[model samples]
Structures are given as C-alpha cells and as structure tokens.
Target chain A: MIYLTLFWTFAKVGLFTIGGGYAMIPLIQQQLIERHGWVTPEQFTDFVGIAESTPGPFAINIATFAGIHVAEQHGLSPLLGSVCSTGGVVLPSLVIILLIAGAFHYAMRHWAVRAALEGAKPVVVGLIGSAAFTLLGHTLLPAGEPFHWAAAGFAVALFALTHWVRIGAVSLILLGGALGLVLRCFGVSL
Target chain B: MGAGAEGQVSLGRRLWALTLTFGKFGGITFGGGYAIVALLEEELVRKKGWLTQDELFNIITIGESTPGPIAVNTATFVGYRLAGVLGGVVATAALVFPAWLVIVVVSGFYLAFRENTWVAAALAGIRVAAIVLIARAFLRMGQGVPRTAVNAAACALAFALVALLGCNALWVVVGGLLFGVLWHGVLPRLRGRRAEGGAR
Candidate 1:
C-alpha cells in the first residue's frame, strides 16, 4: 500500500519538477511532509541535511530515500522501494523528452510557432523570477528573524568569499559548518 | 539541412547525436546547471550557435519556474528547437539517463560504505561546493534583474513578500505574471492613449 503511494507520489513529482532539484523543494515538502505524514518536520529536516550531503541531485536523493521510508513501512526492500518511486518521478520527464523530440524538428521552421514561443519567453522569465524569489524567501529567513543573524552573516561572508575572493562553494559550506559548530560549542544559541 | 556538414542523417542518427551530447553533459558536468551555464552557453550557443543569448536566457528562466532539471528542460527546448520532438526526446534522455545511471552506481557504492571517514570528509567538501553553487546563482540572478525602477521595486517587493511574510511561490508567480503584464503591456497601452490624445 505504501509502496503504491510512494510510486504514485514520486511519479507525480518526477513529472513536474522541471527546473531541477531546488524547484522541487516546495512540492516535495508538500507531498512528503505535509500531506503524507511519512516524516515529521524534524525528520524531514534531517532527510534534507543528509540529502544535501550526498553525491546526487537533491531531488533524486530525497525521492529515493523517502521512497524507502514509504516502501519499507509496507515491508518492501529498499532497492525495490527506491526503484518504484524513482520510476514515478522520472516517467513524466522521460515521456516529455521522447514526445517533444518527435515533433520539434519539424516545428523549427514554423514562423508563427517561433513567434509565439518568443513571446512566451519573457513571461516565463517572470515566472521563474517569481519562483526563485519564493525559494529565497523561504530559505533566507529563520522563521521570523531573517533566518538568524549569524546564519545571515555567514551567508553574506560566503557570498563575498565566493564572488570576490573567487573561492569554491565547497569551501564556504565547510566554513559555515565550522562556524556553526563553534557557535554551538560556545552555547551561542544559533 | 545543416546536418553537421554531413549528409542528411536519419531521425535515429540525429537523436543519437543529441543523446550523446547531453548524456555526456549529465555524466561529467558537475556543480549543477548554473556552473554549467558558461559551459552550455559556450557549447550550445557560442560554438554551435544553436541559440541566441536571449533565447538561452529564456529557456533558463522557464526551467527555473517549472519543475525538474534545468539542464533537462534546456536540452529539451534546444533539441526541440533544433530538430523538433525527436530532438527533445534525444536531448532529455541524454541528460537524465546519465544522472540516473550515476545515481544508481554511486548509491550502490555509497550505501555499502556508509561509515567511511574519507567519504565523510569528501561529503563535507561537496557540501561546501554545493552552497557555493547556490550563491553563484544568487549573484547571477542579481545581475539579470531589470534595471528599471518598477522592475527593481517588484524584485524588492517580491523578496520581502516571499521571504519575510512566508508567501507561497504560487502566489509570487501570480503576482509576477500580473506585474509583467501590467508593467510591460497595460501600462504601455495606457500611455499610448495619453500620447495620442495629447497629439489630437
């Protein structure tokens, strides 16, 4: 039963999560945490932390791990569990690719098609910008206080280090984590 | 027509070519889409000249708004633009097939070595890298923001509404849609009538 649910949910997520892992955060949060009750907010937060720390795309990793939770609850193996949910999320994008590939070549030379698409682009940009803002707003603040001043300060420093100092991102995350650890050790209440 | 300077290739051949192109990108390209933007812009736009910068930017934006992989969507759009449906299929398959394969392989090994200290250290390094990638995107988006006062205001408002107020993305998207249409379309129409009346 849970496997079935995992399959369907992931399939839905896979179909829609078009702009990559980050874009899927809202939907993933909705389906997995809010709707399903598969994991609590704290557990989901841990899931996200582990997912972020892993090697693959955040979307894929989360889907895989969460699928395991759903399937295993219903007595399924982790491997099968992972595959079932992954299949669901991937199927849409796969179909989209295959379906669109068949006709796009012929449509390339169509003037009206091109014009309509061109017109669409600015609108799409606006939408994307909107979505980006939505994600930033969610992640930027610490509940009500702009996501903790220390974290905010760390974010600023990371930005400066990356852009101005030309440091790599991996370095900044480590630095932030270390900073967080130090604060935690010092009982700074971060 | 411009079949890579080769003779007219079959649909199968074209699809194969696109698959190979994006599949390679999926497997080897790291640091995600924003990092690969320069690479992609170079390979697909500058060197290949498949899309103009504006067109590429449009695809990037659309991918951001939509669900799924930005690379995958861009590949679909570009491939579709180049060759139609076949191109879209080939490109998307190429892009994701690699990620899927890599994930499986990596996961198999990773699950087995869950306690490795080096793996932990490497992950620490990777975490930092990922954060940097996100930051890079922030800067890039900052650069792309329209310089107009209205556009600027909209950005700030959008930020505060979403960030400070915990506004949902769907709402922000709705707001942007309305804002774009009004600012770019309705406002111009209103101004056009005023100019015409003044002339009269």
Candidate 2:
C-alpha cells in the first residue's frame, strides 16, 4: 500500500507539473510535508540540496530520495520504494511522449494548445518564485529557533556572488560546503 | 513512426547505444533540466547525428510545454524517434537509472550521517546555497516571460496564493492554464470578430 501510495503520489506530480523540476517543488513540498507527513521540511531542503548537486535530472534524484526515505521510515525495502517512486514519476512522461510523438506536430499547431502553454509559462515562473521564497523562509527562520544570522549572511553573500560573477550550481554548492566547514572551524554552526 | 537516420541500426544495438548515450547524459548533467538540453544538442545532434538541429529545437519546445521534467520528456521523445516505443522506454530508463542510483546511495548516507556535526554543518551551508540556486532559477525564468500586465499579474497572484495563502500549487497551475485560454485564446478570437463586424 505504501509503494502504491508513493507511486501514485509521484505520478500525480509528474503529470500535473508542466514547467520542469523547480516547478515541481511546491507540489512536492505540499504532498510530502503537509499532506503525507512523509518528510520534514528540513529533510526536504536537504534533498533539494543533494538533488541539485548530484548528476542526473533533479526530478529523478528527488523522487528517488523521497521514495527511499519514505520506505525506510516504513521499514520497507528502500530499493523497492525508490523503484516505485522513480517509475511512477517517469511513467507519465513516457506514456504522454510516446502517445504524442506522432501527433505532437499537429497538436502544437493548434492555437489553443500554444495559448494554454503560454499562459502556464508565467504561472510556472511564479511557482518557482514561491518555492524560493518558501525555502528561503524555512532556511532563515525555523520554528522555535532564533533567526540564523550566519545562514542568512551566507545566503546573501552567495546571492550577491552569483550576480557579480558567473558561478555554476555545483560549484556554488561546493563553495558553500567548504565555507561551512571553515565557519565551523571558527565555531560557527552555519 | 517515421524511420530516421538511425533506422538502419539493429534493435538490440540501438537500445544498447541509447543506454550508453543517455546513461552518460544521466550521469553527467548536474544542474537541472536545461543542462541536459545542451548535452543532448552536443551529443545527439552534433556528434552522433541522432537528431537534427530542428528536431532538437522541436523536442525542447515540446519538452517545456509538456508535463514532467524536461529531461525525461526529451529522452522519451528522442528515444521514440530513433527506435520506436521500446526505444523510448529504454532511453528513459537508462537516463533515470544513474540519477536514481546516486540518490539512493547518497540518501542512505545522508540519513545515517545527518546527526554528525560535520555533515550537519556542510548541509546547513548547502541548504543556503540551494536556496540561492532556486532564487536564481526564479529570476532566470522570470526573465523569459514577456512583460505583459496579465503575465505580471499572474506571476504575482501565483506567488501570493501559494507562498502567503498556502493554497495548493496544483490548482494554481490549472488556473493558469484556464487563464491563458481565456486571455490569449478566447479574447483574441472575440476581438477579431468584433473588428471584422465593424469593418462590415
């Protein structure tokens, strides 16, 4: 039942999300944290970090992580949970693409289809913005904890760094970890 | 259904080739969906000639517009084009395999070492970096959308609804689709009709 639940939940995520990996964040956050209680907000943030740094698509990495985490929590087989979750997420895309590969050209020609996609575009952007805002809030201020000055300052520095110089996601993440270790040496937790 | 340049290859060989190619893509792409797009262009279009430039563009367009991650959608498309339905499945699986494996191992370690001080510190920093990355994505994606009042309104409304009101994101997305149809599709048609009638 858990496997089925995991699969179905991810399938809905895959089918409903149109914009890409980042756009999937809010829905996943809601489903996993609020609705299912499968993952904590902190763990979800960690998953996002790992997913971003790791090779492969962000969607696949996060789904697999969530699956394994959920399965482990239930004392189920982690591999099986990952299989179910990953398979569920990929199934919709496979089916939809296969079904439409032939007719996609014709379908895309329709003004309604294009219009609908165009309309979804800005909304997708908003969704990503929402995700960033939510995650930022969670990172900077957790429940029953004092404001994290070190983390906030780090975030601001990184944000400013990105604007001033070109930095890749992986590099920025590595830099953060290194900087974190340095800060720890100085007895700063964040 | 059309047999393209790769039609001459045997099914088994083609499947193997797809596994290797997409597997590499799955292993190497670090950032997100768009990174894989560039990889596909270089490997499939330029080096391997599996897809033409025009076809690649079409795939990216379709990938973005369709549901799910753009990378997975593109893999499905490229695979299906090369070898048929079976090819599509193989390519998608291959592409997903590496990412899944890495996460499984990493998550195992992540949960186990989460209590460790050093790991926790690194994670704290990584978390902040992750937020910055998301914020950067937000800005980049925002730039792509045209500067129309309706688009600006939709973006703000979506943000407020999800971030402030705690509304379900799924419904907001659906609302966006409907809003698009009404604003872009229906309004234009009605305006065209009115203009034609006035001319008559």
Candidate 3:
C-alpha cells in the first residue's frame, strides 16, 4: 500500500506539473511533507540539495530519493521502492507525450489547453514563492532546534554570490558542502 | 530483398543508438530540460546528423509548449519520429534509468545516518544553501511571469491560499486553471462580442 501510494503520488505530480523540476518542488513538499509524514520540512530541503547536486531530471531525482527514504520506513528495500516510484513518475510523461505526438497539431491548436496553461503559470509562480517562504521558515525557525545563524547567513551570502557571480547550480551546491565541512572542522557548530 | 533486410537491421541499430545517446544525456545534464536541449542539438544535429537543425528546432518548440518535462517529451518525440512506439518507450526509459539507479544508492547512505548529529550539523550549512537555491528558483520563475493585474492577484491569492490559509496547493492550481479559462478564454470572447455591439 505504501508502495502504491508512492507511485500514485508522484504519478499525479508528474501529470500536472509544467515548467519542469523547480516547479515540482512545492508539490513534492506538499505531498511528501505536508500530506504524508515521510520527511520533515528540513530534510526535504536537504533532499532538494541532493537532487540538484546529482544528475537527471529534478523531479525524478526527488521522486526516486524520497521514494527510497519513505519506503525504508516500511522495511521495504530501497531498490524496489525506487523502481516503483520512478516508474510511476515517468509513466505519465511516457504515456502523455505519446498521445500528444499522435495528434500533435490538434493538441497544439487547442485554445482551452493553452488558456489553462497560461493560468497555471501565475499559480506556479505563487507555488514556487510559497516554497521559498516555506524553506526560509524551516531554515530560520527550526522549532526546538538550534538555529545555526552563521550557516544561515552564509546561505544568504551564497545566494547573493550566485546571483551576482553566475555560478552554476551544481558548483554552488558543491561549494555549500565544502563550506559546511570546513565550518565543521573549525568547530563552527553549523 | 537484400536492401529491405539491410534497412531493418539499421532501424534496430538506430534504436540502440538512440537509447545510448539519451541515456548519456539523462545521466549527466544537471540543470534542467533546456540543458538537455542544447546537448541534443550538438549530438543529434551537429555530430550524429540524426536530425537537421530545422527539425530539431521544430521539435524543441513542440517540446517546450507541451505538458511534460521538455527533456522527456523531446526524447519521446525524437524516438517516435526515428522508429515508432517501441522506440519511444525505449528512449524514455533509458533516459531515466541511470539517474534512478544513482538516487537509490545515495538514498541508502542518506537514510542510514539521517539521525546522526554530526551529519545533521554538517548538513546544516547545505540546508541553508538549499534555501537560497530555492529562492533563486523563485526569483528566476517570477521574471517570466507577466506583470498583469490578473496574474498579480492570482500570485497573491495563491500565496495566501497555500502559505497562510493552509489550503491544499492542488486546489489552488485547479482554481488557477478555471481562472485562466475565465480570464484568458471567456473574457476575451465577451469583450469581442461587446465591441461588435458597439460598432452596430
């Protein structure tokens, strides 16, 4: 049943999300964190970093990793769980794209579909916006947990650095890990 | 008879090649679908000559406007164009397979020591950085959104609905779809009708 839930949850996300992986972050957070208690909000952030740092599609990585983590809680093997979740997520794309390819012109010309997407854009922005705020809340306000002010400040600095300096996302993530390790070595208590 | 047999052999070979090429792209490209597109052009158009530049561009345009992630959608289309349904399935699965394997391995290590305080402390910094990266995504996405009253209202409403009101995000998305139909679809037709009446 948990495996089935994992498949359906990602399948639904894969079906509806547009604009790709970043867009799917909030939905993943919603389904995996808010809806199910698979991982805490803070852990979800870590998973996001992991997903971006690793290769492949953003959503698929999240689905695969999150699926493995959640499935392990039920004493399931990570391998089978990952296959089920990844299969569920990719299934929609494989099926839907094939349908569109079959009737490419007609699908493209449909006005209601276009209008729905136009509507979805702003909503996606809001969803992403909410995700940003949610991440900030988790970082800044980890209730009953020690707030690592220094590390949090460093994160802000990195944000400014990346925006102004044009570093790639993968490099930035690597830099974050390196800095984290260095901070730990120096007894920074991050 | 020889020519027909030779053609069949090449089709099988092309499907295998398609699997390898898309699998490599899926394994390596880090950023997003657009990253895959640039690499696809280099490999399929410039290097392999599997597709012409114009054909790639048309596929890209279709891929972008479609619902699925651009990378997967493009793979499906290219594979289908090259062979058929079987080719499309093979290409899509190959593209996703490598990453799925990698994630499974990484997830094992992560879950094993998830409760370790040392790991948590070390990850604190990355967690902070992750927040920033997400913020960057938000700002980047915001730039593309049209600065219209309807859009702005929708953005604010959606934020409040999900973040403040704790409403289900899915419902917000559904509302946006309906709102879009009313705003972009129905409203325009109504205005045009009103304009025709005024002309009369």
| Ranking of all predicted structures according to lDDT, beginning with the best and ending with the worst | 2, 3, 1
Tell me the tens digit of each residue's lDDT in model 1 across B64-162: 445565555677777776667667767766765555554455554544454555444444333333344444544454455555666666656755665
Cα RMSD to the true fold for all candidates: 7.0, 6.7, 8.6
Model 1 Cα lDDT, one tens digit per residue, A13-129: 877665556667678889987898777887677656555545434565667767666666677786677777766775566566545545545764764445434433443334334
Candidate number of the best TM-score: 2
Candidate 3 residue pairs in clash (backbone atoms < 3 Å): none
Q: Give the per-residue lDDT of model 3 (tens digit) for A84-163.
A: 78888778878877776677647547777567667777776676577567656766767788775876678778878976
Ranking by TM-score: 2, 1, 3
For every prediction, compared with the true complex, DockQ reads 0.19, 0.45, 0.36
lDDT of 3 at B75: 86
Native-to-model Cα distance after best TM-score fit, residue B191 in candidate 3, in Å:
1.2
Cand. 2 TM to true fold: 0.66
Mind giving the per-residue lDDT tens digits that candidate 3 earns over B8-116? 6677896898899889878765545545655564467646667654445445545544555667878888887676788789888888887887787677565555556
Model 1 chain A weakest 10-residue run by lDDT: A119-128
What's the CA error at residue B200 for candidate 1, in Å? 4.2
Interface RMSD of each: 6.3, 5.2, 6.5
